[model samples]
Every structure is written in structure tokens, then in C-alpha cells.
Target: MNSWLEVLKPEEIEEIHAASLEVLEDVGVEFQLEEARAAFQAHGARVAGSRVYIPRLLIEQALTAAPERFLLEARNPARSVWIGGGETVFAPPAGCVYVQATGTARRSAVPADYIDLVRLVHQSTHYGTNGGGIVIPEGDFGSDEEKFAWLLLAGHWYSDKPQMGLNLGAKVSRLALDFSRMAFGGRPGCRILGTINPDSPLMFSPEMLASLLIYAREGQGLIVAPCSMAIATSPATLAGTLVVNNAEILAGLTLAQLVRPGTPVVYGNTSTIADMKTMAIALGAPELSLLVLGTAQMARRYRLPSRAGGSLTDAKEPDMQAGLESMLSLLSTVAGGVSIVMHAGGILDSFLTLSYEKLIIDEDTGGMAKRFQRGIEVNRETLALEAIADRGAGGNFLDHEHTLKHFRNEIWRPQLSDREVYQEGRDYQAYTLAKATQAWQKRLEGYSRPVLPEEVEREMLDFYHQRFGSEPVLDV
Candidate 1:
């Protein structure tokens, strides 16, 4: 985590600081709704139409009030996640449209696709958390709400990885809480994921506010996202965009803390830009990468857990552009010490489409990033100053005891990515995309759904049935 600070020179930090202050003072931010304007005004902000002037002092005070670190308790305490300060967490892309399967290259993500994705995530040792509501196979479910419901059900059924629940209305939030209560067998605060969108002013919608309150009251962690778009929905400049994003996030954090102080929440930013030329959202832009890393730092300033965009690219096809963009943004966030990096796979066009090949590649990228975060060991054996002197020059250490001891520990072995020569490893027949397909298939073949007690599952399903007036399909 200290690496993040070390990477930023004093001048750079000062620049970011100055930019933040300018954003707070000169650029300001827009509060779309009157209620949010009223809230900010009540909270000592100056409001002029939709533009609000937030004093640096107020921003600093809010930062002071924000919790620096918190623990996300899982149903199994052993699996609980510490999301702030020193620890780091990862999440796959959410709300994507396609999934890659084994044997097949890529396929449209449907309800069944969700089930497979959940199962795969559950079984993977690599991924630390589960994200449902990813648009794999477009669900047969009636509406976005219904599709979200299916995601919640699949998450409950497939994984115990402290999953993110669906982001429907307040009723779904309540149901999700109830589902957690049942799934964990009355364990409160089992670390379910909830979202609060700051698309308007400083305030949350009644439904969203209620959801946050429910999650907070239950001791659940929240992932609040200010889906700000640069040069469009938000400020055109990066600094201005960051400030608006920060204010929006700060607003969510303040509300959550006020509702239930000390409730764990991640400072998540999915802010991106609409391309000036194409009028399309561009995730591959260098500015987006900088935004992600910068947001991580700003979140750290508040001593809060952080989440940011990752495995994101503007490429239509999963090619070099996709790999490069994903690697750059993801590594930046990881190095910036973001606790939860979402969009780790299957995102395109600012997250409207999901690519199976991209997902496979991203898994490799995520593995590499996690390895990078582990950093280099500085133990006596690893320092090897003495060993180097002993060997002098031109001595190969491959067969040495020190080499054997440190090499494995120092190196990261990738699954989907290839490093072999053309003649070796089946003539490098297995491309990462293909390997990912195989691995995903193998995982599904061996997949075992979480063993929820029959009665508990029945109760949860019954509740959904009663609420929706139909038997909830557990197929996915």
C-alpha cells in the first residue's frame, strides 16, 4: 500500500492537491435535483442553480469524518475481507452482456450464463470476491429488474464468496437482506454487495437511501458508484471530473455513516469519458487510466476502502488494444492501492458488452496484477548480496539452493497466458483465449453449487415466489 504513495512524487501529489482545490472552488459541481441542492446548502455549501461550491474546508472535514479502514465480515469469518488501509480485494466485471465458455469461443450471456459464471467464480482460487448481475447470456427474465432478481438468486445459490447482490429497487434490497439472513442461517452482516448511484445531486433516491440504510443496519458493506461521464454528464476536465466524483462519493459515504456510523463501504468510482470525436464512451483512453489511479489516491486520503474500473477497454474486439488498456488501468489501480477493482473481465464499450475472450485475458491480467502487488521479497536470502559476491560474475544461479528457494516465491505463474516457445507446449497451440475457454469449461464440469439447507433455500424461494407471484427458477 505504501508503494502507491511512493510512486507519486511530491510534485505530482502537490499537483493533484492543487487540482482538487481548484475543482472544489473554481470548477464546482452540479447538483441536479433541488433536494440535493437543499442538502448541500443545509450542510454549508453555496448553491447556484445546479452548480454547487463546496469549500475545501468542508471537503477536508468530511474526509476526516470518513473511516480509514473497515472489515467486511463474511458468513464464515475466515473468509471475511479487510477492504481498507493495508489489505486489498478484487471483483470481476459486473453487468456485462456476453460470457466465454469452454470448447466454444464466446457466447451470449443468458440466465444460464450467470449460473456458470457464479459457479466458476466460486471455485476459482484466484478471484477473491463474487459479482453477480453481470449480463452474461441476456436473461429471459422480463425486465432489468427481473434480470437483477435472477442474479441475486444465482449469487445465493452458487457462491459463498461474499457476493454483490442485485441493484434493483428497495423491495429487492430488502429481499436480498432476507436472502442473506436465510443463506447464512441468521448470521447478520454477511457482507453482501449493495450499490448507491449518485447520478443526481448530493442525495440518494429514497429507494437507494433505504437500501443503504438496510445494508448499513445489517452491517453489510456498500459499493457506492458515481457513474459520472467526463465531457458529458460530468466536468470536461479530469480534475473537475475527479472533484465531482469525489463529492458524489463523499456524499454517499456521509449519508451511510450518518445512517449507521462505521458501516463498511468502498469508495468506488466508475467515472469515465465520452469520446470527443466519436461521441462514444472510451474506457481505453489514457485519461481514464489516470482517473482510476487518481481516484484510488483520493479515496486513500479519506482512509476509506476503494474500488475503481478495471479490465476495461474501448476495443470492439478482444485484441491487443483490449489487453493493453485492461493492463494499464488495472495495474494503475492495483498499484494505487485500490482495495476492490471491478470490471476485471468481460467489459467493452464502457461496459455494455461482455467478451468471453476478454474475460479470459483479464483473468490472466488480474493474476499478474495481484502478483505485482505482492512485490519483491527483501529477506536475507533474497537480498543475496553475499551470494552474488560468492558467485562473482558469469555464475548461473538456476541450480543453486538460493535460486530454488527464492525463484518460486518471487515469480508468478500464469494459467491462461502463454510463455512457451513455438516448438514447446503443443507448439503453443493453446492461446490465452482458448486456454481460458478450457479452464472455464473444466471449472463448470467440476462445479458444485453451495449446499444451502433445503429448508432455507425453500424459504428464500418461497419469499420470492410470494412477492413475485411465480415460482422462482433456481436453474441458473
Candidate 2:
């Protein structure tokens, strides 16, 4: 395993842990659902109204019970990813309502756009899973259920990689699971991942709890993330924000363990300070690097897999601002040793929209980060003193065996980025944009549908009707 980079010392993590425990025992966390409240009360916690005062002992127990690493079983077992053990996995942009496509203004995405994005992700070399990659709320389907069913069919049909499950609360979540079952011939596997986010300011909504319980009971991979906004929901200071974020993660992880011990739940967070003047969430601020590094330390303390940060930016388009900010966030994430990174591509405008050009650029960014994570090998073969001795001083080793054998693995390359020098006083930005646009079109037009068996495809459609009741038939 590659060595992990750290920003906080042991004492700092301890201080954060102690402060988080104090917050849990004093201020308490609110659970809107009766079942979640009851579960907390049943365990050793005191309940007052919707708030639950959890003791430090209960948190320690949950941390002890949770596994350090687990397999997210894929339909193709070879593609399965192991989360934890200093390993990192990445996914594309997910749950965004709008897309800023090439040569067009921002608009609500449709089904075809969603499918094309999935195909692109399936073809990308960098991403390990297509985790809830697109969120097209206003699709061609009549109902949300119908739209979701078709989306699942398309994702499962286009990619054999592991994927993310939907977050449509409890009742609708079942439809996605059933569809996945049909996709893989009724196998009870944990390929689909789900997320449980606490409504910030120490609260978890009823709908969030319902989905958490459903996904936990169904034996799926769960990400316990809290979207904490500093100075608005959390405290103004970064350390203070960590206390609030850690508490939410602990509460969610405890709930998952209580539902079913040994369940694969990831310790996750996306907390950042809000802009003081405008009060908007600052997703691309430089301070986010610290948050990502802190999340890694806390996850290590609990011995659970962690996730955060990505090719993220607050820029409106794929420009230089987007490039700098996304790289800053991404390098921090990779260095922090996050197990699974969400929104690692295509996110823009503080995550309100996705951009196709940015997606391509982010894939390239992820490739660079992955290569960095490999670190440098220092064995005798890599040392190559023999080759050095054979070549002598002032002699070029470009034709030597050592250089020939190692160059490919030793050097990094780019796909979307260009190496040609632009003439002075030329419009380089336009050239970049035009190149990205051409690349995006080339990939989408060249995509071919994967071979999902006829029986399986038919079963998938039948399963949709068997679950959705056929009121809104899919047009695709």
C-alpha cells in the first residue's frame, strides 16, 4: 500500500475526537424519524424530543464493530473495489440537476444526456465505478419512478462496473434494488452503493433515515456524509466544523451497525465554510484541502473507510479558474488517502451543474492523481546501477534495457491536455475549449452499447413493471 499523507498530528485527532464526543453528549443530534430515535434510546442514549445524547462508549463500540475494509462486490467480480487499506477509488459527477453542455447554456438534463454521460464514464480509464453519475430530474418519463427505472436500465446496460444506488428515500429505493437484481440474475450482491446525509445543524430528516435503514437492511454499501456549511450550520472555525461533521458521521455509522453489524459503511463528509459576505457555500475555497486532510485522520482513528473532495470547483464553466481549483481539491483528496471519492469529475458552480468539457478534463486530472498515489518504487531493479555502470558518465541511456523496460510505467501521460506551444498573442482559451468540444463529441458518437443478454434485458423490463405497476411505461 502507498504511504498516506497527513495534515494533523495524533494529538490534534485526539482533540477533535474529544470535542466531538463533548458535542454529542451536550448539544446532542436530532433524529426526525421515530425509528431512529427509538434505536438510539434503546441503545444507551438519552432522548429528549428529537435530540439524542449519545455517550462516548457507544461510539467506541460502533467503531470497534465496523470492519476496517470490505469489498464492494461488482457484477463482474474482477472489477470489484476494496475500500480501506489505504486504497482510493473515484467516481464521476452525481446528483447534479443541470448540465452546461458544449455550445449551449445551462439547462435541465434529459434521459439521452444522462445515458451518454454514463457511456462516457463506462469508457473512461480513470473511474472505478459509475456511482450515481447523473441526476436528470426532468426526463422524458412521466413519473420519477419511471424515469429512475429507465436510468437504472441504461446504467446497468452500458457499464459492467460497480455503481451507486439511488437516494430516493425508502419506498422508491426498493425499485432500484429490484432492477439491479434483474440486471444480474437475482444475485444478492453489494454492487450498488448508497449515501445517508444528515440535514446540517445537528439534524437528520425522516426521509434520510428511511433511506438509510432500507439500504442498510438490504446489505448495500453506505456512505455516511454530512453536508455541513461552516458559519451557517457548523461553527466558523475549521476545527469546530470538524466536531460537528464527525458527530454526524458517528451517529449515521452507529445506526448502520445497529441495523446490521458488518455492514460496509464509509465515513464521509463534504463540510466547508460559507462565504461570510454572501452566505453561499464555498466549495472551491483553499480551506477545503484542510477539511479533506482532517476527514482522513478521523477515518483512520475510527478504522473505517473515508471519502471526500474531488475535481470540484465553483466556477461557472471549464476555464482556468476551474482548472486550478479542481486540481487543488483533487490533489488534497488523493494525498489524504480517501477510500472512495465522489463528484471527482464534471462538477461546477459549487456542484449545482455538471459540464461535459470539465468532465473530460477531470478524468485527466484523476489520472495524474492516481499516478502520484503510486509514489516511487526504490528496489534494485528501479535503481538500475548496472545500466548506469554500462552507460558511464556523459553517455545517454535512452537506448538501454533499463530505460526501455521502465519508461512506460515510470512516466505519466495526458489525453485531453495538449503539449503544443500556442503562438504569442493567440487565443489559447478558445483553442482549449474547441479541442475539448471536439473530444467530447468524438467519444459520445463513437460509443457502442454493451452486450446485455436478451433474457436479462427482458427480465429487467418485466421487473420494472412488476415493481412500478406499469402506469408509466418507459419510452426507451
Candidate 3:
């Protein structure tokens, strides 16, 4: 792999790490869960009510205990993905309650839309793992439990790829593990990947800590992410925000290690600058990429897999703004060597809406980014000295055997981009929208839901009925 993109110098990284340690040792982090506070107190941390001042020794121990990488297994073994070890895995977007299609008004996503989005990820050539909470459906289930059940069940039924776990709380986390075991059958290894976000400004909510502890004790992969909006949840300056972000993540990592040593933990950062006017986190800002770069550097320093960046945009539509912003963030992610890329596709309108057209467009963008990450292979074969000799100056090699043999793998062909000469017709944006719409429609039409065992499907259906007491939403 090419050299990673670095925003922080080596000395600057040490300064940030030292500052974060100081913050953890002084200001400390608040843990709302009693269990978390007790664990910290037992582990030589100073516990004051809900706040725990973690010592540098504890942080070092946790960093040493956490594994650098792990494997996430899928029902279909071929679809399994490696979470770390210099791997860059693209997962779909999560937590979007609204969805938009080309030429359609933004509105609450329904059950059918969720199913369709799952199918899109299942058919995608770029996305690897089907991230949980792909969309929070409206009027679909009666409660969070029912909604989570549908999301997990439909994700399994529609896609056999590796999946991330639901981190809503303890109940949902347990539900994810139970469902995974029902499908994969008493697996000893990690079958689900999960991410827990610490509430910004150095705080961990009870529900998040509960999920973190549950996942850690169960030996599931956990990502401790802190989304600190600069000047809002964290300090105004980017460097100050990094200090806060690192401290919160370190606290969570130490807690995970206390619960279960050698747990797979990814240092995650979704921090960015807040829109000065609205005070909302701006996903499209260039500073977002800088934070991802800095976060990756910090994760490398700790020798852990890092998760950050995505095909992010704040555009209301999949237009020029969306394209530019998404590409900028995604390219930075791949260049920075983020191991697990969250929100890689389908997000829009400051992550409030998931656009179907943008899903297809971002797939192409991700493909391009991964291709760029691969860089150039300059071996004997690729050197093409023999081809140059075979085809003298001014000679054509288009029909050569070497050209025919390597073109497909050597060239990154785009699925959505039109490379032909332009013609007078609809505008570029209109053309792109039409193409993306057709692409998703084709994928849905051609999609075949992955088949599950009869016993497993029946067991899941029984559990659904017993738990939710409602008919399962199995339509795709």
C-alpha cells in the first residue's frame, strides 16, 4: 500500500496523545453507568460519582490488551470480511430515518424502503459489510425492539455478507448476539461488528456503556467512537477537539479491556466542525477529512484498527455538491488508510436522509477510491517493457494478447459514469440521476434474497412472533 496521508506530524501526534492523557488524568470522563464506574474504580481509576479519572497506566494496559485486528464471519463463508490488518472495509450508512429518491421529496423511510436499501447493499460490488440501522423505518414496528428485530432479520435474509451489530442499548445488543447465534449457530468467534459512541464533551451514556460492556464480554468487535462537533460538543479549535475525542475514546477502550482483555476494538472518530450558523455538525466540511487523517494517525500509534470517514455529504440532493463532498471525504478516508469505513454510502442532508440515487453514485465513488488506494503495481509484467518492444514506435497494441489479458483487471471500469462523448440532451445532473435510478432499479429487480435454512428461518420467525407478537415484515 502507498504511504498513508498524514495531517499531524510525528511530534504533533505525541503532543495530542500527551494532552489527551492529561485530560483523562485531570478533567476525566463521566460514565453514567454504575457498572462502568465500578469497573474503572476497581482498575485503579479515581471514581467520583459518575466521573472517572483514568490513569495513564490503565490506558497503557488497555491499549496493550486490545487486539489490532479480528475477523467478522458471514453466513456464507465467502462473504466474510476481515476487520483489521491493513484492510479497508466499506460498510453502508446507518441511523438515517428519512430517504429520498430521484425526483422525490424527502420523507420518512418505510419498511419497503429499508428492504430495498438492504438489497442495494447486497448487490453492491463496493460495500462489504451491511452496517446496522441502515434506516430507521417509520410506521413499521410498534417499538424499538420490533424495529431492531426487523432490521437484523431483514439484513440477514436479504444479504449474507458480514454485518455490524445494533448498538442502540443493552437489549438491542443482546438481540443482535442472539440473532447471530440463531443464524450462525453457537459461534465462538465474532459474528457481528458493533460501534458504541460516547456522548460528546467527555461523557458516556448508560445505554452506550451497557452496550459496550455487553459486546465486549460477549467477545464481539467494538468500535469506540466519539463524534465531537467542534465549538459545540467540544472545544472550538480542531486540536483541542482532538484532545477531547482521544480522551473519551481512551476511556471507553480502557473500560472494554477491563471487561474482557484482548477484545477487538477500533478507535473511531466522526468528529467535525459545527456549522457556525445552525450549530449542527457539518459532514461536508474539509475539516472532516483532516480529522479522519489525524484519527487514523492516532489509531496507528495505538496499533489498532481505525474507523472513520465515508462518502459523506450535506447536500439535500445528489447533485454537484453531493458528488464533490462525497468524493472529498471518501478519498481522504481511503488515503488515510481507515480500516472500517462507516457511512460509506447513501447518506445525505447532513445524515438526516439516505438517498437511493446517491447509494449507486457512491458505489462508483468507492470503487474509484479503492482503485486509487491500490496504487500502481510496477512489477515485471506491469512494466510492459516486452509489450513496448513487441509494438514498436507508432504501432498499435490494442489487439495484442497482453493488452487483452490485462485490460479488465488493470482498468477500473465505472458502472454509473458515462465515459462516451457528450451529446445534446438532458443536463449532466439529470442524466446522472436517471442513470443512478435505473441502476438501483435494475439491482432490485435482479436481486435474489440469500436463502436461509428452513429451521433457522422458522426459529427466527418464532422468536419474532414471541417477542414482538406481530407479523414479520419479510417483503423485499
Best by TM-score: 3
Q: For model 2, state the Cα shift of residue 384 in Å.
A: 2.4
lDDT per residue for candidate 2 within 1-476, as digits (tens), equals 35677888999999999998998999999999999989888888999999999998888888888889888766677888888888888888788889887679999877667777888888777778873647665755657767776777777878787878777777667766776677677777686888888988778988789988888887778899988888999888888889889999998888888887777889999888899889998888977888998999899998999989988888998888999999999988998899989998899999889898888888789888888878889998988999999999998999998999999999998876778876888677877777777877898788777677799978886766776676333333
Instruction: Mark the 10 consecutive residues where model 2 has the least summed lDDT.
Output: 467-476
For model 2 the local lDDT of residue 430 reads 73
Model 3 per-residue lDDT tens digits across residues 1-476: 55888999999999999999999999999899999999989878999988899999999999999988888888888988887788799999999999999888999988898888888898787889984789988865789788888888888877888888998888999999888888886667888999889999999998999999999998889999999899899998989999999999999999999999998899999999999999888999999999999999999999999999999999989888999999999999999999999899888998899999888889889999988988898889988889999998998989988899899988999888988898987588788889999999998889887888899999989988999888796863
For all predicted structures, in order, the TM-scores are 0.85, 0.95, 0.98
Off by over 4 Å in 2: 131-133, 421-426, 466-476
Q: Residue 319 deviation, candidate 2, in Å? A: 0.4
CA lDDT of every candidate: 0.70, 0.83, 0.90
Better of 1 and 2 by lDDT: 2
What lDDT tens digits, residue by residue, belong to model 1 across residues 22-133?
A: 6656756654455545655777778887777777776666566556776655555666676787666777678777554434545566777667677777776656677557
Candidate 2 accuracy as TM-score: 0.95
lDDT of 3: 0.90
